[model samples]
Target: MKRALLGADDLFPTGGEAPPWPGRLVELDGSRLLVRDTPATAPGAEPALYVHGLGGSSTNWTDLAGLLAGRLEGQAIDLPGFGRSEPARRYTIAAFADRVIRWIEHSGRGPVHLFGNSLGGAISVRVAGLRPDLVRTLTLVSPALPFLDPRRSSQSRALPLLAIPRGDRLATRLLTRVTPEQMADQIIDSCFADPRRVSEMRRLEAVEEIRIRYELAHYIPAYLSSLRGLVSCFLRAYLPGAGSLWRIASRITAPTLVIGGRQDQLVDIRVAPQAARVIPDSRLLILDGVGHVAQMEVPRVVARAAVAMLDEVSRPDAERPPRPSRAVRVGVAAAKPGSAQVAPA
Candidate 1:
């Protein structure tokens, strides 16, 4: 057998050591959230927070956080009900946004640079719009804005809350008996391009996730109720994101970066222009051949883009509210309004 670069024995450095950083629990609106802080690894490091999307835990940002910590004090939180955090009483976008806001306040890092991906991106956008004072700048990746192209398939992307089997009784029954592997497989597949490529270590991690979900299954009814409320309140109507994104985006006062991938199956790149147009100070960047997972697909590019957005405003000579993001390439004509074509971004 070949020597693995990162062998099991090298899993973590051990000198009977304290973790380089410690994770703490914060109370946000009655919900306990898992938060970890990476102190200034450099002479002077700015503060930043990484928010994960629905069905994702803070682990999603672990690799990126490590890289970012080199330049800034890094923080990432497991939103209520995801990761190590307990589920929130209500799991709506607003609810999640409120949780994030509270976490920021709890961290005592005022006006921190906040980066979010997918659903996290959407919530970050909303929070920045309503509470710009708390946010120094915003970075969004393949944000899950409501681009309801009715023609596309929803085979892979399933919001665990929304994916709860319909009807309370059936869902309760299934939740009580379902295996963690079953839940983890569906959850992992939804985020990755190919489940076969999910890597062995991640597979092991999924085992723990499954165990957690199983333990929490007793709250299936509550999750279902929250799921319904979220879909009804935010996902419906002529408005988007429970119909708040456009309004929120239009009012965003902080400098912003809107990024997406050309091949994002869930969120079309076409949405980037509208995001640019709405966020008074936002710039758009569209990466090529990437899926919805831009951070995972191209972390360096996304991080560089985020740093640029921050420096765009942070630099003394830099101006405010940069010209709308120039990276948006109009998507191909597939889901043209009223046309039956399935648009490909």
Candidate 2:
């Protein structure tokens, strides 16, 4: 694979660019998924797939995908019922992973770079573990791996609602009170260390997306069920078993990059290092002052780290540098003092 050198100017889309990438519905195994395609700028660029977190869509990857477009022909999928995709009968992590695997197979893009955020991260872990042949590199941004501490983040506070009967309905009623604009603001506030980092245009786009999704009959159910499924997975992770995500992470064969935001409120930043430790060939990056969504919060930094990993993997084994004995922390200057720390080796 040829590597494309990205200058500082290439890290973001130019001003006055159009909206997010165009998307179309793709049918694979009788299921339709909405996929947004970002064409690569460099010749011979390899394929890459992006998966969004719960309550997010393919648009979540716009900035990061655009930043890496020179080295990767990126396709970001709106997992079942999230964006424009059709709902699935099951919303389990395994089900979501299967959809991703099937898409890679159907598109003949196997062994491609795989990217995921939050819920998508867990799904990507399963895909990289179960279908190692289909993933060349795995990049997880604040992956929602099973964390024992639910109180660490405000988002986890909603987990109990999933246990209550008709919690989806309750959620729907609560959400109905808030306008799409308010909802969008709330999401931005929760996901970003500084909500002001989000451009006004992006905020409008998010509100528009929420407005459209609110009309979808399956949207709320899909979101709630997926959350319940995630919580279930977390519980299962506690049991000593081979089926756990940690075990699966240990089995991943692809070169992995685990990116975490120091101020992430969804998935605890503390779990980031542990995730890197489990993967046999993995590098860890924790960005200071970043929140749950590092890709959106700091696309340039994320792209730099991602491109570096790609370059490293493209090199011949003899020429590649040795793996770090401990996580080599980077991008900390972008945050506050002592906000992030390297996990002990």
Candidate 3:
């Protein structure tokens, strides 16, 4: 298949000179946006649904969106409190999954393929497990599973979200002063294995949006509470907490593709084994030197793998592709210097 691409800045054309978007405001859950795209503009002709991590809006997937859009129609959401989406009253994993279901029902795009990064990955897994009927297949990039080794600094930030009483309100007050650059930096550090590849422009965009988020909500307390609940799903044991999605992984019957960055500090290398063990009919790919946000860190490689996985899922049972080996699965997706071939050499 031929690769589809819009040179760099071309993919993200919002407002002043942004690329023409596929659809705008299909629906508004409060203030957040439900964005959609079609392959008419994208190159690959691969249909997909993407989910971003915490504190991220659909914009986070801007470039990735355009890249994937080339293959097929694509839709991405700004989960409550993260992007243009307004925070819900409660931000639990199940609640987020509900919103995903709502979008699916509302869009009449049932059985769509799923892809997610970091916290988004956690939510994707939950949605697939809970609503297997809705997903054609599951693809996770640096899914935010709990750290076998705790991230002290990050843990401090996430703790209140899970355990502190009314901590969301306090978190908002504390983080309101957070700049988008700071937000971007933290995410880059936490999510990418090799953040150096993150362009200056991507950092700036994230910086701007993070600042905008603080000003959007009027019910600061509730928003904070809901934000906490949403993150708690990712921060609690196994990132979504124990018996949540991690436990659900073993029961997932979906054809799954799991990718992790060797550079990801948020969710470590070991988690891949856990995912491989639990997910039935699954393939695991670990991109070394890549971080939690492998998709962004190396869009081409990640996007290619994604399209291949989805395309495989879409094939007839007789044409399904073979599984990938652990050797082919490990390493940095973008920065590494080798092909990940699955067949015997």
On TM-score, the leading prediction is 2
Cα-based RMSD of the predictions, in order? 10.0, 5.3, 7.4
lDDT of 3 by residue, 141-190 (tens): 76765544555225344555546686657667767676656666666666
Give per-residue CA lDDT, model 2, range 1-345, as digits (tens): 122122354554554434689999988788788999999998999999999999888888887888788889999999898989999999999999999998999899888999999999999999999999999999999999998788877777677678889887888888899998888878877888876676677777887888997899899899988988888898898899887999999999898889888888888787888888888888888777788887887777788888888888789999976654666554434442221111100
User: TM-score for all predictions?
Assistant: 0.75, 0.91, 0.77
lDDT tens digits, residue span 164-224, model 1: 5566566656656767666666554444443443444555565675577556753455445
- In candidate 2, list every pair of residues with a backbone clash: 111-134
lDDT score, candidate 2: 0.82
Pairwise TM-score winner, candidates 2 and 3: 2
Relative to the true structure, candidate 2 reaches a TM of 0.91
Which regions of candidate 1 deviate over 4 angstroms?
Answer: 1-22, 150-169, 172-188, 194-198, 218-230, 233-243, 317-325, 328-345
Q: In angstroms, how far off is 217's CA in candidate 1?
A: 2.3
> Between prediction 1 and prediction 2, which has the larger TM-score?
2
For model 2, what is the error of residue 83's alpha carbon versus the real structure, in angstroms, after optimal superposition? 0.5
